[model samples]
Target chain A: MSSKKLFLIGLLVSFLVAGFFSFYSSSQPDGLQKATAEQGLDLTVVDSANADSSLANYGVAGIENERLSGFLGGAIGVAVVGIAGTGIYFWVRTPKSGETK
Target chain B: MHMPDGLINAQVSIGAAVIAAGAITVGLKKSKGTLDSQTAPLAGLVAVFIFAFQMMNFPVAAGTSGHLMGGALASILVGPYVAILVMTVVVSLQALVFADGGLSALGLNLLNMGIVSIVVSTILFAGLMKLLPKTRISIIGVSATVAFISVLASAGAFVFEYSLGGNATYNIASVLISVMSVHVLIGIGEAIITGLTIGAILATRADLVYGARKFLPAHNLLIKESVVA
Candidate 1:
């Protein structure tokens, strides 16, 4: 298969997982948080400064529907990261030997 | 795991930020001549995939959840230097836009997940590739094993940081055991995902895989065999 096709497949899978399948993800705390809680260290844990942000906790602030909020938040992340990553890579890559910019 | 605010004291966090910044600078220099049109897209795709998958946390060991750090996966797909840049982009965006990780602890998060994981996994992957046969299955297996170790290494890095300047007082022994044990379970999940994803890409576009490059050309294999015989 072509690189384009492969890239598209990857993008599609990312969307399927982040936007749709993320709803089924475990709601429990992650490994670090769990371990910290088990050791009674949760009391000292400070909240993120951006905890009040609209996109905090992987959900949009205004969106009441959990599914829509998550999907929108994740989609926005994918778009931003994708564009930023692509732009950075393209700019950072050096030209081929003897090839002009 | 993404480190939130106040996980470690501000002193350790600032120190880690400096180290992380230095590594990223070196990575950018190393990756400049390595990436081209054919590989740049794959590198970007890796960042996007890691960002998306990180949002989908799978349950590990009862109530604890774990997600893909993508260190081993990215390192194997694109070389280590590029992988660092890729992970940095993903982690940075997660903290800045989604606010998933704490802003103050961004350096800590980047150090463990991006620098440490990729560096350790790359070293392991390179060693395993030399030891094992240059085959797709072997590549997949090595990826899985390295992925598992990468998670543990990330966890170890956290413990080290905490030891230096942890805010709360606790038994270091207990913290070590609990953190390492939970990460062991999460490592299994990471291995499976990393293995299967690499397998899929190897089956389709083996040429695009950086780790598999030395294994792809039949002439290279024949030459090595002839030398051995």
Candidate 2:
């Protein structure tokens, strides 16, 4: 398959996983949280500085609908990460043979 | 694991931030020499994929969940230098934009999740690649093994940090056991995902997989031998 086709497929899969399938993810605490809780250590005791951000906790702050909030937050994450990652890589990439930095 | 604030003291966190910054500087220098147009997009895609997968927490135990760390997978797809850059982007985004990990603990998170995992996996994968036969199965095998161990390595790094400056007075032994036990199961999940992803990519586009590229011709040669059988 062509590189472009593969890249598109990868993007589609990432968006689908983050935006749609994330809703079905387990709501239980992750390994670190569980381990800390088992030992009576509350890791979240001190709120993050960004805790008040609109996208805190993977959901939009003002959105009332759980599904919509999470979906939008995730979609935004995909776009931001995609753009940031691609731009950085492009900047860091070695120039082609005929090209000058 | 994405550590929240108050888990570690300010001194250790700041110290780790300095070390993480140093490693990233080295990674940038290394990646500039390694990455070209062909591999750069793959690295970027890896970051996006890791970010997306991290949001999907699968139930590992009754009350525990786990998600993909993707260090080993990224390092296998792109070289370790680019893998560090990819993970740095993902972890930084999660901390700053999503508020998933604590701001103060960002360096600790980057150290354990990005630096430790990638460094250990790169060394392990390189060693195994040298010892094992150059085949797709061997590449997948190495990926799974390194991915599994990398999770434990990350968890162990956290335990080390927690011992140094943990707020609570929990027994160090118990902390080690608790962290390692849960991560053992999480490691299995990580192994499965990493192995399957590398295997699929090798079958379709072996040229793009950094870990499998040197082995592909050998793999094809083995296939030819089997055809004669």
Candidate 3:
């Protein structure tokens, strides 16, 4: 396959893999959080300013579906990151006419 | 760390978001005046490699697994700006499509992992490289050691952020000590992987490797002399 095709495929595969892992992630806190809890630091954590934001808790209020909420959250994250990251990269790496190979 | 939404205070989240945005803007500008055909695709490939490696989580303890944070690796392999871009892509994908991190916590995640690790680590690596001999082995060693320090730096950044926005009433010292302790071990893993990967790339295709550039001319010249001999 062409390099372009390979790059595209790799990007898509990363999205799919990330989506799968996000969906199946453990509900328990991650290592650091778990350590914090054990060390008596969990209580010091505070709520974010946008505590009431729709995506704040990874759910749409009244959605009442954990699986659905997770799916939506995952999809939104992928889109935002992918779009933002690609946009930044393209903008940064755009070649001038005189610089093109 | 891929902070979930609701983990940090809103103010901290917003603040981190602003910082992340500013850094990304600066990175874009820096790349614009300098990025060439050679560097761009390498950046993208570095992103993919990071994503794949992140999937292979090592057991952290009895029941938990931790993965590589490619900030140091990316920065050492590519430049810091491109490394940040690579990490931003990875984190953003994890947050949005995989739900690995919280959507609302995107800024915090980017700041802790992407900006702190890549930018800080690159600075440390570059500074150390300046002092070390410009050999492939020295580059690998410095990259590995700095990768460890960068991970520790990120852990420190996380602790500071948590102190500011954490909901708990726990002692800051305790939090710092605990997080840093575990991260030290994690950093060793990061260093080994980073060292090996960079070494492999340098051995095969130094031209394609960003951080290995310092060794390229000398190594290439040595190769040519050997061929002539």
Off by over 4 Å in 2: A98-101, B218-229
Highest DockQ against the true fold, candidate = 1
Model 3: runs farther than 4 Å from truth? A1-30, A40-89, A92-96, B219-229
Report how far residue A94 has shifted in candidate 1, in Å.
4.0
Superior candidate under TM-score, 1 versus 3: 1
Query: What DockQ does every candidate get?
Result: 0.71, 0.68, 0.21
Question: How big is the RMSD of model 1?
Answer: 3.3
Candidate 3 per-residue C-alpha lDDT over B141-173 given as tens digits, one digit per residue, 9 for 90 to 100: 988998888888888998899889875566788
**What is the clash count for each candidate, in the order shown?**
0, 0, 23
Q: Is candidate 2 or candidate 3 better by TM-score?
A: 2
Model 1 Cα interface RMS deviation (Å): 1.3
CA lDDT scores, all candidates in order = 0.88, 0.88, 0.70
Clashing residue pairs in candidate 2 (N, C-alpha, C atoms within 3 angstroms): none
Question: Candidate 3: lDDT of B99?
Answer: 59
For candidate 3, the docking band is: incorrect
lDDT (10s digit) by residue, model 1, range A7-83: 99999999888888999989999999999889876666787877888888778899999999999888888888889
Could you tell me which 10 consecutive residues in candidate 1 chain B have the lowest summed lDDT?
A: B217-226
TM-score of each: 0.94, 0.94, 0.75
